[model samples]
Target: MNFDPQTLRYDERGLIPAIAQDAENGDVLMMAWMNADAVARTLQTRRVTYWSRSRQAFWVKGESSGHVQHLVDMRVDCDRDCLLVLVDQTGPACHTNRRSCFYTALRDGAEVEIMAPVADPD
Candidate 1:
């Protein structure tokens, strides 16, 4: 059975949550929103693409930062409301330059910075 992007459940806004993860180590990289078109583009191009809620536009990962995410696999949740993207992440996945967007850890009711921003290569 061929998978279709429209078959996946989307919110009223026609968006779905997509979680990107490191294909090798299984580390979660980041979470972003994706419309059906974004999903099709990601699958077609093998580059992870997202819908920026704030910008209200298509956001292709690493388009500007060079931190590209090459899609290895895409999985839909059982509820068909979420996506898991296994990818080859090149650089910092967070806009803050951290390896992942989930940098803050709530430990014992206190927020802790577990990851630091990646230094610019040059």
Candidate 2:
């Protein structure tokens, strides 16, 4: 059967958590929120789109940052409440220029930064 964006479960704000992963190496890039429209838009355009809770608007990845996330696949969780977006990521996924937003590691009751930011092209 065909898929429908509306069929997925959403929270009270009509938003679902979406996790972006690198399709090539399986690194989790980031997590963001997506409304139904954002989901549909990402599928239609093959560019990842997210609903910014702070900005309250739709953002097409790499629209300004050049760190584009080209959609490779989109998977729904068994509960239908979460999404996994497999993508071909370009540049650093994190705004801080790291490969992932989850840069800090909590080990032995201590927090440590495991990853360093990538050097800017310019």
Candidate 3:
């Protein structure tokens, strides 16, 4: 069956949450927002694209930094309000140069640094 982006649920701002995960390791890389257009673009181009709420624009993963995320697959949640993007992540997925944006963990009511930022490339 064919997929349709309009069938997915979106927030008042016409946005939905999207999570990026490592296709091989299953490690979650980052979470971002996507509008219908971004979703369509990602599927059409096979490149992960996200809606930047702050910038109010479309952010194609690794467009500038070369930390590109090549879309392996895209999944819609049961509620159709969220997305899971399996990707071949190139470099750090976080602005801090970390592999994943989920670097902090709340354990036992304490915040802990789970992963350090990736060192800058030479």
Candidate 4:
């Protein structure tokens, strides 16, 4: 059966959560939102694209940062409310320059930095 982006469940805003994972390492990199258009764009372009709720616009990964995420595969959750995107990621995935956005760990009721930011690309 052919896949349809519209078939996936979306919130009232027509958005769904998308998780990015490292294709080679199986490490979760980040989570973002995606509208149907963004989903189509990502599939068509083979590049991960997301909807920026804050900016109210389409955000193509690495558009300015050069930390692009090339889509290796895309998966839909059982409920179809979320997506898993396996990708070949370049550079850091977090705005803080860490390899992943989930760099903090909650241990013993305290937050601990589990990973350091990547060195400046320059």
Pairs of residues at least 3 apart in sequence or in different chains that clash in candidate 1: none
Q: Mind giving the per-residue lDDT tens digits that candidate 4 earns over 59-80? A: 9999999999999999998999
lDDT of 3 by residue, 4-112 (tens): 8999999999999999999989999999999999999999999999999999999999999999999999999899999999999998999999999999999999999
Off by over 4 Å in 4: none
Q: For residue 54, what is the lDDT in candidate 1?
A: 94
lDDT of each: 0.95, 0.96, 0.94, 0.96
Candidate 2 per-residue lDDT over residues 1-122, each given as its tens digit: 25689999999999999999999999999999999999999999999999999999998988999999999999999999999999999999999999999999999999999999998777
TM-score of each: 0.96, 0.96, 0.94, 0.96
Better of 2 and 3 by lDDT: 2
lDDT value for model 3: 0.94
Q: Which TM-score value belongs to model 2?
A: 0.96
Question: Residue-wise lDDT of candidate 1 within 5-115, one digit each (tens)?
Answer: 999899999999999999999989899999999999999999999999999999999999899999999999999999999999998999999999999999999999999
